[model samples]
Target: MGGQQSRQKHVALDDPESKYVIPQNTHKIKGLSRYMSAKADHDRIVATRGWDKHDENMQSMQMLKGLFKNLDPTVMKAVGDIRGDIQLSFKYDFKRQLLLIKVIRCRELPSKDWRSKMSDPYVMVRLLPDTNRQGEKKTRVVQQCNNPTYNEIFAFQLDELELMDMKLLVQVLDKDIISRDDVIGEVIIDMNTFKFKENPVHTAWYMLNKETDLSITGEIDITVAFQMPQSLFVTIHRATGLAARDEGNASDPFVKLTIPGTSVLYQTQVLKKTLNPEWEETFEFPIALEELEDRFIIFHVVDEDVSSSNDSLGQAIVDLKDFDPDRGMHGSYKLADLRNTERIRSKWFQRITAEEFSEALYAHSMSKQPSFIFQNQRTGKRVNCIVSS
Candidate 1:
């Protein structure tokens, strides 16, 4: 190999023309250079801003804008071209006290991408004045389509008066993975206008209108357990996104639990100055297992005020029949607006008139001052209600 290379070197020197020969046409090996440049840039960034800052910047880039609300470019396009109609059907089950709503489909929906005439649409249904978010339901997203068919049914548990007063809000939104979902259109249906019983299956096509008011509130986590023959336990886990009721945009919050048709009120210790409070406090109630069937528990979130009575932040109602005797129930519930004590008392009175209970007396609304006491000599069941103003 040395002799051959020496001969070639001598020939090349003798020829002198080899020096003038054009170099072979070759592509540049740019991959390693590009990689080295990137590595240098990365190293400089890490050295200048530390690993923690570097990682934070990278994470921020991948974070989602949000799940819904707050209009963006794509959403704006859909909102402007809101020309569509939605089909819906309604049915009420008298025995279960549930109103079933079926989101049939959407037709002639406006395309988010005008060039391709494509859209991604879904339906969000809720009962108006839903304080606890228990009446909200949503459909799956249908992608790259102008018309989407979603024959989905959602059920809401409500009393007769509540059903009469409630309205159904149906919103058609365009699904966007990059940012908040765009609101294409919405429609509000008044329950009182429809005769759900006589017309049993009330199906109609509602014209999509402009977006309505969007009111949102905080949520609370709670768990309920049944301890056999006559004991009920409740735990207030935590609360998030609570509304500010005091100065400096904070609240000293506490929870009050009460069961109707019984003189039971349980409260948790107050926490100081926070929008999100975690109180893993539990309380118990003395009641028989059989009595839970037609009963409801009310959870009231209040802000403790040293100067005056505590201010109510919100309230929630849970039907005790939903609880499993063996396992009980646990959930993160949305808080609803607190109604007046008179309104709550009137509702309780309506229940008493409807149901056949032998010598039953109950007092509720822990925020109220007045309470009643009654005893039935025939049944020998004494009812006592003691509440604070």
Candidate 2:
């Protein structure tokens, strides 16, 4: 059995450790032993219900633990040990549902060259949880100056909910002529920490910290349908605001869909020289309904490179458990960085949604049961199924 393949042996029911042993009837027994069968049945049901409740409680606790995690001042700090300060102003229009951001200027930015003591500095701005809208802007480079005055204003058409959930990421960089632009520093402002009115603007200065993961900004539209018990259909509709990976401010974009931990990989045809691509192609996966709870569909948008490896522009993941087997699902999803997407399911809103959906499913299952009572013959124990009137 050490080297060669070995088959598992079956256990005999009468063996002491065998789990397949049948329960004693105890119908003729006159003592407490007569309650054995009924007690086992009751205990089994209670164990199942208790385990489910415990699982729900654990999920709730996890949600509570991270409810204010983003609002923490420590978490909103810059990423690294760099030196700089960027001033920004923000205001929200409640009636029009817009967020206005003004990039004021930067000071004390780190120099990016060995030859020159001064560096050309500029600011790139994007909204986090990059909603499939025009949320990116760039300020002009003040050449050979560590301190640059931008005074540029950018607006995002965000609803009240989006404004509340989104964060602003501003990256100061040294624009290069011969090489790729080098980042000077970054400032992340968590929107939850601010209270904005319709007219007044909020302004603040933030220290520029070192760089984090590559900027991920984009959104994709997809449609999902479950074809009963055996097939799952997914449609790659289109993508917008994809990050530019090529020199000409565009990317040869395509979508790759896969289920993690499985060998199933699918792709869409590449659209040349466009930040927005519409494929509207559909693919099918051989999946069963029972597997939905354990499956996640990842839509990875890639930039096709002829001479090099394909670049992952961004990715969006859909939890199969969120699908409605009856109507299915169709929506636009914001693309998240590959490095930051592993914890998407654990986000605060996702947790609340999962709990609500689970509760609704549990209620539906419970509603299908009939209210009735029965007596166990072996133990003369009465069982009741009561429903509230």
The top-ranked prediction according to TM-score is 2
In model 2, pairs of residues that clash are: 80-210
- What value does the lDDT take at residue 33 in candidate 1? 29
lDDT by residue for model 2 (212-291), tens: 55566889998888776677788888999998999989999988776643435678888999999999787777778888
**Can you write out model 1's per-residue Cα lDDT over 1-389, one digit (the tens) per residue?**
11111100010111112221222211211332244345446745785765654443333211211100011222222223556899999999888988999999999888787777888999999887795479568999998887899999999988777988888889999988899989988888889987877888899898787665343269999888877668777778899999888899999998877676554456777899998999887766677998888777888899999999877778777878767768788998888663423345444433433221111112112111112222234655544432122
Once fitted onto the true fold, the runs of candidate 2 whose alpha carbons sit more than 4 angstroms away are 1-217, 343-389
Q: TM-score, each model? A: 0.38, 0.39
In the order shown, the candidates' Cα RMSDs to the true structure are 34.3, 20.9
Off by over 4 Å in 1: 1-216, 338-343, 347-389
- The superposed Cα distance between candidate 2 and the true structure at residue 196, in angstroms, equals 16
Backbone collision tally, model 1 = 1
Question: Considering summed lDDT, which 10 consecutive residues are worst modelled in model 1?
Answer: 4-13
Clashing pairs in 1: 131-336
